[model samples]
Target: MRIKTKGFKKRTSVDEALKILLSHTPLPSIEEIGISRGLNRVLACDILANIDVPPFDRAAMDGYAVRAEDTFGASQTNPIYLKVAGEVKIGEAKEIEVKPNEAIKIATGAPLPKGANAVLMYEYTRELDEEIEVLKPVTPGKNVSFKGEDVKKGEILLKKGRILKPHDIGLLASFGIEKIKVYRRAKVGIISTGDELVNLGEKLSEGKIYESNSYMLASLVKTSNSIPERKGIVKDNKEEIKKAIKEALSNDVIIITGGTSVGKRDLVPEIIAEIGKILVHGISLRPGEPTGFGVIEDKIIFMLPGNPVACFVAFETLIRPMLQKMQGLSLMAYSHYLVAKGILKRKIPSEIGRRDFVRVKFDGKYVEPIRVSGAGILSTLVRADGFVIVPENLEGFEEGEEVEVRLFHNYFPAP
Candidate 1:
C-alpha cells in the first residue's frame, strides 16, 4: 500500500464538529416498556398522575383517632376520658366513625376514620378497659396525611426527557402504572480495523497486539444507556473494511476504530467518504485530532484513533453526547459528574489553537497532571482520577493555580 504524506488540510474546532454531529442526530422511536425496566431510560412523554398519591386521608402515625375538641384542655393534672369505639389497621376497608368524646385505635398508614380530625398518640393516653384517658391536647389535622399530599391528580408526575431512576419506578408503581412510554435505546455498532490487531484468546504473535478499543467503546456505549453491537475486527484491506461498514449501517450509529488519520493505511476515512458524506474529518483537540465523523444511510459514523486513550477521549468528548441526544435526553442530562477544586501541583504545557484533555490525579488537596509522551499510553487514564480540560484560547495552567477537575466516577467519596 502506498503511504499518503499529506496531513489534514484543515482541522475543525471541537465545538463546530460537535454542532455538526448533533444536527444530523434524531431522537430514537418511542416504545412502551414496563416500569421494572425503565430505570435510566428517558421518558417519551410527560406522565400525568391519574389519581392522587396516598389516595385518601390516612394516619401518619399509630395513634387514636378522635375529634380535636374532645382532647382539648386534656392534661396530666386534669385528664379527659373518652370511650374506645373501634380500631383501624392498615389496608382495612371497614368504615369506622369517631363520635363525639370517642376515640378509635389507628395504625400508621391506615385510613383516618370518619368524623375524626386528629390523632392523639398512645403515649399521651392511658387505655382503661372500654375508655382512654387523654393527657395531651390534640390539634386538627395532626398526624394526618391528607389525600394528594404527595401528588395531586392531573399533575405532572414526570416530564418528558426525564431519565427514570429507582425512586421514579417506585413512584410509578404507587400509581399502579405497569408500563411507561420511553425512548428506545440506540443500537450502536462498533468496528475495530487494523492489520496488526487480534482478538482475545488468540495466540499473541510478535507483531500483533490484542484488540481492546472495541471492548472499551462498548462499555462507554452502555454507560450512555445505549446497546453496543460489536462487529468484530476487520483488516486494513479496502474491500474488507468496506463490507464491514456496509453491514454496520443498520445500526443507529457506527464507530470505526483505527485507520482514521491521514495515512495510506487509513482507508477507513476514504471508504466512509466514498460511501457517504464525511462531514468533519479532523478536529483541533489533543490526542484525538484524527477523530472524524460522517453520515451513511442516515446512520452516524465515527472514525476514531486506534490508540485506546485517544478513542476514549473522542467518545466522551463527541460521540457520547450524540448518543444521549438520540435517546431523547438533553446533551447535558448526564453532566452530573463530580467536580472538585484543587491547587495544581505542576504546570501543564499545551498549544493555543488546540483543546487539551490533561489526565490528573486529584489527591483532595492537589491536582497532579500525569505526563505521557504519546496518546497510545492507555495506562495514564487508569492511573489518573480524572481530567482537566484546557480550552483552546489558553496555552496552559500554571502550578499552584486552582482548577476544577471533572471526575470520571461520580460516586467517589469526598476527600
Candidate 2:
C-alpha cells in the first residue's frame, strides 16, 4: 500500500492557495426558511422592520398611569390624590384616559392609555379610600416607552449576507417575522481515495486502515455551515478515481482525502489535473504541505493529506473559508473563536519557507505546546487548546515571546 517517490517540488504559498480557492464560482441558490430554521444561515436579503418594535407607546413599569403634570409639586406630606379611572389590562388595549386628578392602573409592557403620560410605582403611592395618593413629582413623558422608540418602521435592522444567530432569530420574531430568505447551504461531497481504506466497523486487514478522514471532513463541512455527503471510498486506480470525481462534481465542492502527495498510488493529483486545472499541487505548510486544490467546471476540488491531522488543518485553513464564501458569510469574520495573548512556554522551531501551525494548550498566561512528531497523530489536535500560526517569514518563536493564540471554539484552559 506504500509508494516511494520524491516529494512535491513546487509548493504554493498560503496566500496564493487562498487566492486560487477564491477564484471558484460559488453556488448561487436562495431558499426561504422559517426563522426557527435560520440559525447559522446567511441572510439572502436585508431584513427591514415592517413595523416599529413596540408598535405603540407602552408602559415601562408596573404602577398607576397618570399625566406627568398631575404629580408635579406633590410630596409625601401633602400628596395629591387622583381618582382611579380604570385598569388597562395587558393585550386588551382598554381605552382608559387619565383626566386631571385621575389615574389608571397599568402594568409593564401594557400599551399606554391615550391620555396618560407618566407612571407612578405602586410603592410610591398609597391607597386613600378609592383614590391613590402620588407622593412624588414626575416629568412629562416619564416612564413612557414612546412609539418607535426601539425600532422605527421601515428601518433596516439586519443587512444582507449577515449570518443568523439566536439573537437574530429573536429580533426577527419581535417583528412577527416567521420566515426569511437565506442563501442555501452549500452541499459538499467528501471522497476518501485509496485501496487501503476501510469503512468504520469493518474488520481492519493488515495493511488497510479505517477510513476516518471522510467523517472528519464531514464534521468540518458541517461546522462551516455546509452540507456534507460522504461519497464513500475509491481505490487508487485512475479511472475509478476519475469516475468518483466526476460524480462528485454535482456538489458545490468536492474533497478528496489521501493520494495527494507524489507517490505511485497518488492518483488524485494526476486525475484532477487531467479533468480540471490543478491550482495548487502542494502547500508550504506543515502537516498539510501535501495538500492540493483545483477547479473543474464550476466546482472546487480539494486534495487533502491522508493523515487525519493534516486533513483537519487543510480544511480549516482553506476549505472552511471557501464554504463561508459560498454561504455569503464574510471570510474575515472569525467571531466564533476567542483570541487571547499568551507567552510561549518554550521555543518552537520551523523552516524558513514553511508555515507551521503548532497546537498548544494555554493556561490563560502561558502556552504549552502539544508535542507531535508525525502528522498522523490525531490526539495532538484533541489535547491542544488552540494553535499558533507561525508565518513563513519568521523561523519560529522564542520562549517568553508574546503570541496571539486563536482558541479553538472558545475553549481555554481552566484556572
* lDDT tens digits, residue span 265-347, model 2: 78887778777987777899887999988889968899999999889878878887787777777775334567899999999
Q: What is the lDDT of candidate 1?
A: 0.88
Error of 2 at 347 (Å): 2.4
Candidate with top TM-score is: 1
Q: 39-90, model 1: which lDDT tens digit per residue?
A: 9898999999999978999998898999999999999999999999999999
Residue pairs with backbone overlap in model 1: none
What TM-score fits each model? 0.96, 0.93
lDDT of 2: 0.84
